[model samples]
Target: MIYQQFQRSPMQTRISGPRAWLAMAISLSLICLSLFLLPFVLLFGAITLGCLVLFSRVYMARQIAKLNQAQANAHQHDHTTEEPHSHVYNSVNIVRESNAKETHRMRQQGRTFEHKEDEH
Candidate 1:
């Protein structure tokens, strides 16, 4: 409906004289230039893509290193500030309880044991 409202009739259309020639010439020149520069354009695009990949890899590596350093600092700070014996005991207990629960659940689901020995 909107397109029909805005559409111009064929009688209103006009392409004549120097303006049409200029438009055709510009388009032809662009086509010729693009054809001539196709190889160069592709090479430049590949180089740009490679550079971007290298830059992203370096940036991600730096970010990961910073995260690891921060995690290490936090871990070190926690150990230094807390009572080690209690923390260690609590962590061990938590791990044991979680392992026990997982084992029990797997047993209930009939997936507890793996066949280690070769069957004849």
Candidate 2:
């Protein structure tokens, strides 16, 4: 009696007819479809990544170009606002100061005569 109570009743057993076959067919079809589409799915994923990288590079280039244009415009604007200035700020009069020590040293060295007379 105790073992009988523990045993599953036939009424509670799984139904195994068309329902089981339908479930198995659906699962098999899903597996087959996924297998068939796997390559396409991978290819599409790679293409999408490539497109994203290409678009990002193009976008970055465009942004850099825009930034360069803005900098150029800003420089031109700033240049226009500034007054025109002369290239020479102040004329410097370079007066050579003769050092007494340098003059004495030159006098001591006398005249260096290394003149080679032209042989006529």
Candidate 3:
């Protein structure tokens, strides 16, 4: 069997710095020229679009976080619906950290150690 050497294409190059700026400039120039003929311009419509974009981003972020948390909990083999959780902190540096680590003790007999949100 003959072995083939695969090479990455120019199109697949990582975008950064000058390359990214050049691409942006080209795209903006194209859009400006192409869309110059479009007649109607409304400030209300622009504002509405901006608000919709902001709301959608916030909504999607919340949804993604919820899904990730559920997936993480599932991976840790979380069984019960009502789990007793506690806010814990390192005895030394309570002042530095604002977000407390949640401590969970598995009620089941086989599990001995503290089961944090990341149960594994």
| lDDT scores of the candidates, listed in order | 0.80, 0.78, 0.66
TM-score of each: 0.52, 0.57, 0.32
How many clashes (backbone N, Cα, C below 3 Å) per candidate?
0, 0, 0
Residue-level lDDT tens digits of model 1 in 63-85? 99999999999879978888846
lDDT of 3 by residue, 5-28 (tens): 245455546666797989989999
Candidate 2 C-alpha lDDT tens digits along 1-120: 879866987655565688877998999999999999999999999999999999999999999999999999987986777677723232232223366565556566974647578843
Error of 1 at 78 (Å): 1.4
The alpha-carbon deviation from the true structure for residue 94 of candidate 3, after best TM-score superposition, in angstroms, is: 45
* Alpha carbon RMSD to native, model 2: 18.5
Off by over 4 Å in 1: 1-29, 88-120
Candidate 3, 44: how far from true, in Å?
A: 0.2
Better of 1 and 3 by TM-score: 1
List candidate 3 stretches off by more than 4 Å. 1-41, 78-120
